[model samples]
Target: MGASGYILRRLGYGVILLLGVVVLNFLLIHAAPGDPAEVIAGEMGGATQEMMDKIRADYGLDKPLIVQLGLYLGGVVTGDLGESYFFNQPVIELIGARIVPTILLVVAAQMIAITLGVGMGVLAARRPQGAWSAFVSVFSTIGYAAPVFWTGLMLIILFASMLPLFPVEGMESARFSGGPILYALDVLHHLFLPALTLGIIFLAQYARLSRASMIDVLGADYVRTARAKGLSERKVTFKHALRNAVLPIMTVAGIQFGNLISGALLVETVFNWPGMGRLAFDSVLRRDYPTLLGVLFFAALMVVVANLLTDLGYRLADPRIRTGGSRK
Candidate 1:
């Protein structure tokens, strides 16, 4: 299909996928071994049957499962995600307050991972047997294997505790009042560790993938022809090979966006960043179903949008994709 048609088709698919996600998340959250009414009642004090029953009735938890699901679906269709049983706020408002931090964290992490990973990968590809290549290999292995929370902790210890380069567990300096520029800088300082923690594994992944793709692309006939024409090694590698190598990287990056968000949950928890991840963590403890559902729904929406953007990027990067052809 043409670009417009392609986008329209993908959007249709996204809507359907989101619907399925809503239903599935609702069912799975309910099926988990806990009652929101009881949890809320316990928070109020000891949970008597009368109090729990009243709580359920108040939140519509007293309804049949299918009926509740239908009501939720109906609310979702009308942009209502129900009320937060714990926070006593609208679900949308809670998510709206926290989504910015999560977006900033996710986007910052993505940029860091892609830039460093591709750069290292390209460097490693240029000299497969060199020390740099070995370093990249080792770093990738360790990064890929390490848990995100552990990475965050180690960073906090090294940077926050020992060296004291960055703050350990917040988004900004609470006492500092400054202009927009200084405030932005302050936030970036806090963002570094959490972003790095979330990005490391993906960075490792991209590095390995890019290195292999670049190596393969370097051996292609087009690359050989470019080099044979006396193009500089730099031109042959960067201009000819790297362009093709990055296609696979883009694909993987898009597919892994969801995982990146999931990893952020751990990273945010470790760093105590005031993002949707932290909010989701709190919601789980409070059995705040509406808030939790809203987070999941938004997260899924983001993933779908990311994938669509990735497809458009593919069309931009590869003429064959634009023309819907394998043969150039």
Candidate 2:
């Protein structure tokens, strides 16, 4: 297959995967023990049977499960995600407003993870039995093992409480009114802790993966041949070894991007960051079905796209993996 054909095939599979996610999410959300109508009714003082019936009718909750699912799928075809009962706004609008912060958080975290992880991995690979290597090993192990929520708390205590360097909760300080540059700086200032909290775990994984990959690549025949030809150590390590080793890292990084988004749910809750993760947290608590379903659908879509990108990255990283041979 040609590149276009390969892309088309992947897209087709992505659509099918997304449809499956839609059905599963719909079923799971419906299966959960809670009535969205009841939650809304509780918020409005108490509800009579007539009031409850009206509320159910308003949101199409009175419809048969299959009929409701059909209606939802129809709405999805036209780019409608229904309305949020609690927010009194379109689900799409609610998600659109909050998605940026989440994206910013995830992207910042991934950048930190990749840069430090690859650097430390390369360093550790260069001197496997050295102090830095041992430190990397121990640090990565702890980082990978530590719970994300716990990491956020520790960062808050050390950075926010003790040092008083970064803000504990929020994407930006509400009191700041300055130029765009200063505003950007302030946002980054508030962003540091949360991003760090989210990134550290992934950084450990990347570092460990990169270190293992680099060590294996260094032992390969091609690397030995490059070194035997009197190439500089830098060229032999980077140009020969690191280039080949980076493919696995790229694959992991792509998959981790999706996991990072999911992991942000707890991180966002801990920091009170107003992102989709926080929205998701709120939706679950309030039994906001529309918002919850919308978030799940978007998350599934992101994962599918990430996986597709990873496959594409494979072909780019290794020319031997041609589009025709990669079709599945």
Candidate 3:
């Protein structure tokens, strides 16, 4: 199929997947023990029947499950995510406000992970049995196995407490007022530690994937032919081998982006970063159904979109797959 047709198909599939996600999230949230109305009533003082009933009626919780689901699905179609019971704001607006920080954190972390991972993988692949290779392997394994929150704490202690370099928590320094460039720098300053914590957690997978892919690509006949033809080592390795090997790394990176968002929840909680992950965390704590559902819907949508982009990227990176060829 043509590129447009391919994209259209993917978009349609994405819509269906998002709808499924909404239904499943709705069901799951409702299935969980505890009534949102009761929780709200208790917070207001006591869960008397009158208070509970009024709360339920206010939020449509009194409606039948199927009817509530239908209403929610209808609102989703109309771009209305309902209101946040705890925050007393529109769910979409609350999510929209926090999404920026989450995106920044995720993008920064991915860039760090990919750059370090791919570079180390290439270096290790070049000298598979060397000391550097062994070190990379060991470090990557440790990075992969470490818990994200633990990593964040260690970073905070070492960087924020001991050395006193980056801020221990938050998206920016409260004391600073500056222009766009300065503001960007300030945000990056606070962002570095959490981003690094998240990046380190994901880096190992990419490093391992890249190393394996590079080793396999290097063994291919074309690479040997390129070397035999007196091509420079750099050209043979990068132009011939790395180019072909990057496809798998790209795929892993795309999938990991979704995982990283989930991981960011813990990282954000640890660092007290104001992001959607933290928002989701708060929503869950308060049993705020609308806000939690909104976050889940957006998170699932992002993953679906990332997967679609990854497929398109595959076609662009390797022309063999552009004409509806098998990815394999």
Each model's C-alpha lDDT? 0.92, 0.91, 0.90
Off by over 4 Å in 1: none
Residue by residue across 1-328, what tens digits does model 2's lDDT show?
6878899999999999888888899999999899999999999999999999999999999999999999999887788999999999999999999888987898899889989998899989998989999999999999999999999999999987689999989998989999999999999998899999999999999999999999899999999999999999999998999989888899889878778999988899999988999899889999999899999988888788878888887888787687335522
Of candidates 2 and 1, the better by lDDT: 1
lDDT for position 83 in model 1: 90
lDDT of 2: 0.91
lDDT (C-alpha) at residue 205 in model 1:
95
Model 2's number of clashes is 0
Q: Pick the candidate with the highest TM-score.
A: 3
Better of 2 and 3 by lDDT: 2
Q: How many clashes in each structure?
A: 0, 0, 0
Q: What's the C-alpha lDDT at position 53 in model 1? A: 84
Q: Candidate 1 local accuracy as lDDT? A: 0.92
* Clash pairs for candidate 3: none
The TM-score-based order of candidates, best leading, equals 3, 1, 2
Query: For model 1, how does the per-residue alpha-carbon lDDT over 126-213 read when each residue is reduced to its tens digit?
Result: 9999999999999999999998888888998999768998888889998999999999999999998889889999999999999999
- Please write out the lDDT profile of model 3 over residues 1-328, one tens digit for every residue: 7899889998999999899999999999999998888778867878778878888999999999999999999999999999999988999999999888988888899999999999999989998999988988999999999999889989988997699988978998889988999999999999999999999978888888898899899999999999999999999998999999898899888878789889988988998899999889888989999999999998897788778988888889998889756755
Worst 10 residues of 3 by lDDT: 319-328
